[model samples]
Target: MQDSSRFDNVISRPPASGDIVPISAHPAEATSAVLHRQIRHDFPTIARGEGSYLVLDDGRRILDASGGAAVACIGHGDGRVADAAMEQMRSVAYCATIFYTNTACEELCRYLVDSTGGHMARAYIVCSGSEAMEAAMKLARQYYLEKAQPEPRRTRFIARNQSYHGITLGALAVGGHKTRRQLFEPLMPQNVTRVSPCFAYRGKTAHETDAAYVARLAAELDAEFQRVGPDTVCAFVAEPVVGAALGSVPSVPGYFKAVQAVCRKYGALLILDEVMCGMGRTGTVHAWQQEGVAPDIQTIGKCLGGGYQPIAGVLASHEIIDAFSKGTGAFIHGHTYQGHPVACAAALAVQRIVAEEDLLANVRTLAPILSGLLKQRLGDHPNVGDIRGRGFFWGIEFVQDKTTAQPFPAADHVAMEIAELGVAAADYAVAVYPGSGTVDGVSGDHVIISPPYNASRAEIHTIVDRVARLVEDYFAAKNAGGPVDAKL
Candidate 1:
């Protein structure tokens, strides 16, 4: 049991106020008014970015390994997206969706729906994934009201345990992260319930077959629907691939199909939250493409605008839209920036770049190479418990005992330390996305590495090599009773 605190130096911190602070110090001195994500931790000031790397204010070049939470799909500093947004701004920056819809908005929506092969007939563009999810929930409720056999009691939603929907009140209510919800539990709505996620690594029995595992998970969903009263559930909400909360764990084959069946049996809509996994991050334009099941309502973000502008959207099936068209001709919810011309333009440009560059093909071709490299480097490491994901969206879960798959205590902050070391280590400068509560929403540790879609094969290899070295060095230092890294 090594002390986690001994690794604090892994992340460079800025000097205290009144002194000339280092560029990496917390950006909040008496002169600084910015409210940072963490008040106590030092934050590095980013100066600029290139293709797949970020330059710190002090000129430290770090590879954008996880794309800053997998949002920067086309890499940073794309002139095309910026130009598109500026072009839209010059034409029309803001238009109320209720009154006027801009061409960019309409075109972006058309592109999204068309990409779905007409399965998703409508699109509701918003500012964030949370907003998209919130919109989806509202639409589902409104859809039932428009139905001939309207079930007014269908206000509840059934989501999965260890799943992450979003940060807003409605979105958070459906999320199952125990830690994020602990303080806000009293404030969140009580209409949502949770069932087990298809986490085969820990949830499945050792001898269970894939089919049996899928069947068991489907049974759990079925039982949950019965317990909650099928007629009372508006929808069954889940991520096509569990993100953030459970590490990038994709469902087994036939899993989504089985869950969709359960939702159909219960007469509840199926809502797939692809905020983190959709929009070509998983090689396909839509992650559900590989699953062989279509969601009644789908939410997408992250890669949608490639971090050029804040944007997310909801895609609804023809049936959901028809209900509104026939009943009220309107959805009851609206956002001030629901269809901002600038956001839509940026997203359109990003999507166009993805298509023109044929990046999805690159993802499909390179995903196996990255996976193989990771396994070759760290598969036998004691802390490497599981390596799972599809396409370029991958997660590496850390554990205390590999044989038992026992996670390290949350207090150790294993994943966070690795991420910090990746950036702070003089030899290996790469950014990664780290998360906790991978086991039961309070105890597991994992880190995600989702490089930009345009990341070259050499860059992927470099990213994996750096990640492996960081892990090995961190533990080697711990065992030798030293700092977390050799050159931190």
Candidate 2:
């Protein structure tokens, strides 16, 4: 494979004082101290990116594996996306959705609706995934209020534990991860409950059948709705394939179908937060389509504009839209950057490329290549406890013992180690999107591997090979009575 660190630019490379950063890398001491997420060594400042490679400020080129948390779907330095955004900016840059709408917004909405199996209902463009989640919560509630069943449906939402919705107050309220919610638990809203995730590796009981597991989770949802008083619940939310919070774990067969049935039975709308898993990350245009279930309300972002411009949108089903259309004619929500022409135009360009090039096929084909390569390369590694994922999205979960499926100690910083290795040892800049609480809310460690849809085979191999080598080396050094040096 080509050298992963052949970048063309450089910024904050390691200082001579040694690569060990303080706990926070607080500034004011020596070299440029920036408390980066991964303190492997000083991070190289990226100058530019092209295709699936990030050009660092120091003239080194690095393979981009996870697409910056799976955001850069179309690879880097795409002139077409730039042209589209520039054209929209020249025409109309800002028009808040509260006052009026623009042609780009209208066209983008139409494009999304037509692509989503013609049942788009409508689109509400927001600024980010967290904002989209916040919008989805409010919108789901409004749908019922407009339908005149506000009292019975105002009580709750059912989300899965180890699933990430967002960090906003309402989104975090329904988010189930314990550590994320521990500090502000006293400040969160009531009525939102979390259920066990559909993870088979960790959550599945020994000797339990997949059918039985799905049935059990479905029953759990039903019981939660009943506990909250079924008539008072607004929505049951989950990622079609859980991301970040639980790596890339998908539910067992019939999981969504069964869960959807429970929501139908309880008269609560089903909300799928595909912020990290949707928009062809899982091969299909929409992740929910693979499960044979559709969401009443769905939130999608990340790949929506392929990171060319910040954009997120909630896909409302026709029924959800009709309730508001007939009752209030307004959704009772507002955003200053909603349907910003530049974001919509950028998204339109991305969607057009995806459709025209049939990139979903690329995602489908490359997914197996990526998954198989990772497995074929590192399947027997003792530290790799599990390899799970779907589509272009994937994850590698580490454990102290594979047979017992034991995660490395969190303080051991397994995920953080691999993340730093990507730079210090391999010269790659991939994403460490998910980690922590793999066994619970604070003990396990896993790293997400979501390559760009436009990544080439050479780049993917570099990513896989380097990551495997890095992980193996870290353990090897630690086993040899060393500190598992972060400087490599």
Candidate 3:
């Protein structure tokens, strides 16, 4: 029988006809049966985490290149964050927000609102980005009802194509990811209309200038609003820097300004979904900052708590809060654990660490270096079509034909294959976040390499080197007609 321990139980070798092995003999099978993301695959058991590496049960340390969906802003095993959570637990770990509010929750909310320089007057803490998005959508609906004019017809939302908000039904309704929503389409709300995203790579024409492309996209959004009836729209939802949906794709200059203008012209709120790209991931505290416009209602997560605890939030502008105060005197939404004390404490510590340590400065200092390294190493590679991102959040879009920008078929599963190979390979020893359907919602492939904001120059170089080598070797092996190890 093949040694399951050797491969970290990532994959089991097929047995010979004459050989028989019990299912229980597999290392993963022997371990606790946690319902993992994939039921068929034997995933590696992560034993521990330190710095920016995840140590598996087999003692192999995989460098976390993507921060587990871009969450670990301060890296792993942060003592201060842990201590904060512990302290909060000792005081009052759980509190029903409706009955009473705790100090941790209040403080965290204040910190978040203050971080936005009062642009966001209130914060509604939630458990995950999906929940935050759901709250944002619901709040927008409520906001309209609270208005003096009370346009009850404003029940629709306008989002961009190929964009991701979150996974909840309301969020999924607003999101434009075709694959995620395909299975749950019937259950989703039919109140969203999508326009073309500001994806310059695939959406921009060869002869078009950046300004012209932005104008074109703006026009598309305007047309969609017209098609759906502009006054019927409550908010225009988008991610300032498109995250996993389009591989860290950022909009062109003046794109957000144009979109915001359209939203303002129609009296619709601009909702920025910054769950992945916000909280200093893009060198700014808010991803929308660089876009020259602020979101009327913004959802933030992932790096907000830096994965220390399950936490996310929606930030509302003063206008929205004033409307609620004057009309309803309260938001109608409530979650049992809306402001869980422990989660708030951990997030507070994480955000404090981000501010005190001046990690945003580090991100700004290292952004150009990381970008330069990626371009220097993989720019000329045939399969590497585009390298785009800001700050510590970078993505490399892979192409089947670089000249024509033709993507590999969806069946290829190129991004996931690269990610699996990267983690399993001994030499590369890195973990990257990969996603598909970059083109439209079913074709292109890309991998994100967003290391922690605290990663040093040496760590950044290591990440770049390993990622470059992994991509190069994987494609080289395929071109040579050798069997590619990764099946999925």
Candidate number of the best TM-score: 1
Q: What is candidate 1's CA lDDT for residue 5?
A: 20
Query: In candidate 1, how many Å is residue 433 off?
Result: 0.4
Question: What ranking emerges by TM-score with the best candidate at the front?
Answer: 1, 3, 2
* Candidate 3 lDDT tens digits, 15-80: 334221212235455554865443333566689889899888889898999998899999999899
lDDT of each: 0.86, 0.78, 0.86
Candidate 1 RMSD computed on C-alpha atoms after optimal superposition onto the true structure: 4.1
Q: Which stretch of 10 consecutive residues in model 3 shows the poorest summed lDDT? A: 3-12
lDDT of 1: 0.86
Candidate 1 structure quality by residue, lDDT tens digits, 4-116: 22221111123223322222444344445654443444566689889899998878899989998888999999999999999989988899887898999899999999999
The predicted structure with the larger TM-score, 1 or 2, is: 1
lDDT of 2 by residue, 232-292 (tens): 8889999998887778888788999999999998788899998888988999889988999
Cα RMSD, model 2: 4.9
Q: What is the lDDT of residue 251 in candidate 3?
A: 92
Model 3 segments beyond 4 Å from truth?
A: 1-32, 485-488
Superposing all C-alpha atoms, what RMSD in Å does each candidate have to the true structure? 4.1, 4.9, 4.5
Clashes of each: 1, 14, 0
